[model samples]
Target: MTDAIKAIILGIIEGLTEFLPVSSTGHLVLAGDLLKFEGDTAVTFKIVIQLGAVLAVLLLYWKKYLHIGVNMLKMDFAKSKGLNAIHMFLAMIPALIVYLFFKDMIKTHLFGPEPVLIGLVAGAILMIFAARSRGTKTADTVDHLNYKQAFGIGLFQCLALWPGFSRSGSTISGGLLLGTSQKAAADFTFLISVPVMFGASLLDLYDSWDLLNSDALTLMLIGFVTSFVVALIEVVTFIKLIKRLRLEWFALYRFVIAALFYVIVIL
Candidate 1:
C-alpha cells in the first residue's frame, strides 16, 4: 500500500476508536505493526493525529467552550455551571502527574502487543465490574459533578497510560462507579478529553518536529484530516447512543478483539 493509503487506514482506526470505550492506541499499534509502519516517527504520528479528535470535540462543544470562555473573561466562574474549567483541571490532574513521572518507562516497556493485550483484558474486567456495580446514581448530569468525583475520574484515567486501557473506558467506568449517570459520565469523558488529548498531541508533535519533512507532513496531514472528519461523525453518533449502550457490551467487544489480536498478531 502507498503511504497515503496507510495513513488513511490508520486515521480511520484512530477516529472510530478514539472516543469509544475501545483503545485507539492499541488499535493503532497493532495496525501499524501489520502495515510495517513502526518507528519513532510512526509513534509520533499516532499521537499527533489525536489532535484531530480534539478538534472534533472543539467543534462539537464550541458553544460550551465559548460560554466558559466568556464566564472566565467576566470573572464569573459561578455563573458558568455544568463542567467549567475547574472540573476539567480536576479531571486532568492525576493523569497528568502520572504521565509526567512514568511516561518514558511506559513507552519503553508497555508499548507492545503483549502489554496491550493484557491491558485490554484487564480493562474489560474493570468495565464489567463497573457496569455491574454501578448503583444509586447521584450525579445525573455533568452539572451535578463535584470536585471529588472529577478527581476520582482522573485517577481512573491513569489506567489508560497502559495502551489498550482506553481513556474513555476507564474514565466512564470510574464515573459510573462514582455514581454519575451514564450520559453524564460519557459527556464528561468527551469534554475533559479535549484539553488532555490536545496538550499531549502538541507536546508529542514538538518533540518530533525534526522528523517531519515534506513527505511526512503530507502523510500526517492526510491522517489528521481523515481523523478529524471521521471522529466528528463518531462522537456525535456516540453521544446519541451512549444512553442505550452498556459498558458490558463494550467489554465483550474488547475481549473478542484482544483474543483475535493475540492469535493473529502475537501468537
Candidate 2:
C-alpha cells in the first residue's frame, strides 16, 4: 500500500480508539508492523499525528478551558469552580514524571507487538476488576472530584506508560474505583489528556525534526488532519453516550482485539 493509504488507515484507527478504553498506541504498533511501516520515522509519525486528537479536544472544550484561564489570571478561585488548572496538574504530574524518567527505557524495550499484547491483556484485566469492584460513587461530575481523587487518577495513568495500556482505560478505571461516576471519569480523562498528549507530540516532533522532510511531513499532515476530523466526531458522540456505556464492554473488546492480534499477527 502507498504511504498515504497507510496514513489514512492509521489515522482512522487512532481517532476511533484514542478516546475509548482501547489502546491507540497498541493498534498503531500492530498496524505499522502489518503495513511494514516500522522504524524511527514511523514511530515519530505516529506520536506527532496524535496532535490531531489533541486539537479535537481543544475545540470541544475551549469554553471550559477559557473559563479556567480567565479565572486563573484574575486569581478568582471561587469563580473557577469545577475542573480547574489545579485538578489537571494533580491528574497529570504522576504520569509526566514516570514518562520523563523511563521513556527511553520504555521505547527501547516495550514499543513492540509482544509488549503491546501483554499491556492490552493486563489493562483489560484492570478494567474488568474496576468495573466489578467500583461501588458507591461519590463524584457524580468532574466538578465534584477532589484533589486526592485527581492525584489518584494520575497514579493510575502511570500504567499507560506501558505501550498497550490505554490512557483512557487506566484513568477512567481509576476514576471509577475512586468513586467517580462513568461520565465524570470520562470527562476528566478527556480533559486532562489534551495537554499531556499535545506536549508529548511536540516533544517527539522536536526530537525527530531532522527526520521530517517534505515527504514525511506530507504523510504526517495527512494523518493529522484525518485523525482530527474523525476524533472530533468520536469525542462528541462519546460524551453523549458515556453515561450509558459500561467499562466491562470495553474490557471485552480489549480482550478480543488482543487475542485476534496475537493469533493473526504475532503468531
Candidate 3:
C-alpha cells in the first residue's frame, strides 16, 4: 500500500480503539508489524496520532473544560459546580508518579507482543468482572464522584502503563468497581486521559525528534488528521454505548484479540 493508505489505516485503528476498552497501542504494534511499518518514526507516529483522540475530547467537552479553567482562576474549586481543575489534576497524579519513575523501564522491557498479550487478557478479565459486578446504586455522573473515587480510578489507570492494558479499560472498570455508573466511569476515564496522553506524546516526540523527515512528517500529518476525524465519531458512539451499559462487548473483544495474538505471534 501507499504511505497515505498506510497512514489512513493506522489512523482508523487508533481512532476506533483509543477510547474503547481495546488496546490501541497493541493493535497498532501488531498492525504495523503485519504491514511492514517499523522503526522510531513509526513509534513517534503512533504516539502523535493520539492527539486526535485528545482533540476530540477537547472539542466534545470544551464548555465543561473551559468552565473548569475559569473556575480555577477564580479559586472556585467546588465539585458541585462541575468537575473542577484541582480534582482533575488530582486524578492525574498517580499515573504521573508511575510514569515519571518507570516509563523508560516499561518502554524497554514491556513494549512487545508477549507483555501486550498478558495485559490484554488481564484487562479483559477485569472489565468483565467490573461490568457484571456493577451495583445499581452508583454515582451517576462524573460530577457526582468524590475525590477519593477519582483517586481510585487514577490508581487503576496505572494498570494501563502496560501497553495492552488499555487506559480507558482500566479506568472505566475501576470506576464500575468503585460504584460509578458506566457512563460516569467512562466519562471520567476520558476526561482524565487528556493530560496524560498529551504529556506522553510530547515526551515521545522529543525523544524521536531525529526520526522526522519529510516523508515521515507527511505520514504523521495524514494519520493525525484521519485519527482526529475518526476519533470524534467514535467517542460520540462510545458515549452512547456506555449509556446503554454495554461495555461487556468490549471485554469479549479484548479476549478475542488476546487469543489471536497468542495464536499468531506466540505460537
lDDT of candidate 1 over 122-175, digit per residue (tens): 999999999888388989998889888999999999999899999999999999
- Candidate 3: where are CA atoms >4 Å away? 134-138
Q: If scored against the real structure, what TM-score would every candidate get?
A: 0.96, 0.96, 0.93
Instruction: Kindly list the per-residue Cα lDDT of model 2 for residues 167-226, writing each as its tens digit.
Output: 999998999899998788888998998888887777778877988899999999999999
The TM-score of candidate 2 is 0.96
lDDT score for residue 1 of model 2: 90
Per-residue error (Å), model 2, residue 71? 1.8
lDDT of each: 0.87, 0.88, 0.84
lDDT of 3 by residue, 1-267 (tens): 987899999999998889888889878877877787876677788789999889999899888888887888888785346578876877798988897789778777776778888888888888888888837635898888877788898899888988888998899888888888888888888888788898888877777788888999899989989999999999887677755656678878888888887888778
